[model samples]
Target: MIVLLLGILVLAIGGCVCVVWADRGGPRWVRAVAAVTLAAGELLRIARRNRRRSIKRSSGGDE
Candidate 1:
């Protein structure tokens, strides 16, 4: 959840940069979508990893 939110916020900042330097509003969409997808994937991965770690710890597997 936190990771997803952070990723979205980061992607939004990157999108702002893309638009600001879009040259003529041409390459704004593809890059933005690509960036958003990447961030979303990363966010999911991070959340999954954290969930696994917590599960392991709670199960006394941390030893």
Candidate 2:
């Protein structure tokens, strides 16, 4: 689990780097990686938010 988390963190960082690189006209590949990374991050964020919402709902909607 720890390894998996670390891998995700690495990917997130790589994605951020790619975004910056692409913005500075790095290359087509960098832009592609940036797109994928940003999309994955967005998906993960949505999933996490939904999970938290479900947990809150299950626990009588308490804060």
Counting clashing residue pairs in each candidate, in order, gives 0, 0
Q: By lDDT, who's the top model here?
A: 2
lDDT of model number 2: 0.92
Summarize candidate 2's per-residue lDDT along 1-63 as a digit string, tens digits: 999999989987888999999889988999999888888889999999999999999999968
lDDT of 1 at 57: 92
TM-score of each: 0.54, 0.77
Q: How many backbone clashes does candidate 2 have?
A: 0
For TM-score, the strongest prediction is 2
Poorly placed runs, candidate 1 (over 4 Å): 1-26
What C-alpha lDDT do the candidate models reach, one value each? 0.74, 0.92
In model 1, the worst 10-residue window by lDDT is 17-26
Alpha carbon lDDT at 32, candidate 1: 69
